[model samples]
Target: MATFTTAFPRGFAIEVLDVYSGPPRIAFKFRHWGYMEGPFKGHPPHGQRVELFGVCIFHVDEDMKVDKSEYFYERGNFLAGFLSCPVMRGN
Candidate 1:
């Protein structure tokens, strides 16, 4: 129940690994999922460049805005949402 935002940096895109059924014991837990199979199906895993790790919680408003009324970074694991963040390197 805390204000949250996409972890992706400006203009940065994340190569999605997979977005499966939620309620993970790690940290971020969503009651439902958006992305699915078929057009989303693949060999081993399935998902697109997940730059923005969209999460569902009572932190921010439905639009993902700050709301002091209901803001809670459960377990203090904000970074966990970005665990699959794209790895980048430049010259």
Candidate 2:
């Protein structure tokens, strides 16, 4: 998370699209978006807005604290967004 903070200094906005289940087990779809205004993995920022969509399943204990979580998403697609650089002026 810290690494992402530096990459997206303005922060990623997260939205829960839908809740599929509740209680001890919870499932949901989500979207997170942010601008690449800061360095990412040593790569310079291109100031491009990026968005990621995914689903997650979480298991909670009796106390309602998350005990485990599983996240599914297109890793390659997300990484590609960062690797793509904007065309520099007069380059």
Clashes of 1: 7
Model 2 Cα lDDT, one tens digit per residue, 19-88: 9999899999999899988886667788888888999999999999999999999987777777666432
Q: Where is model 1 poorest over a 10-residue stretch in terms of lDDT?
A: 36-45
Largest lDDT belongs to which candidate?
2
Worst 10 residues of 2 by lDDT: 82-91
TM-score for candidate 1 = 0.20
Task: List ranges where model 2 is wrong by over 4 Å.
Answer: 86-91
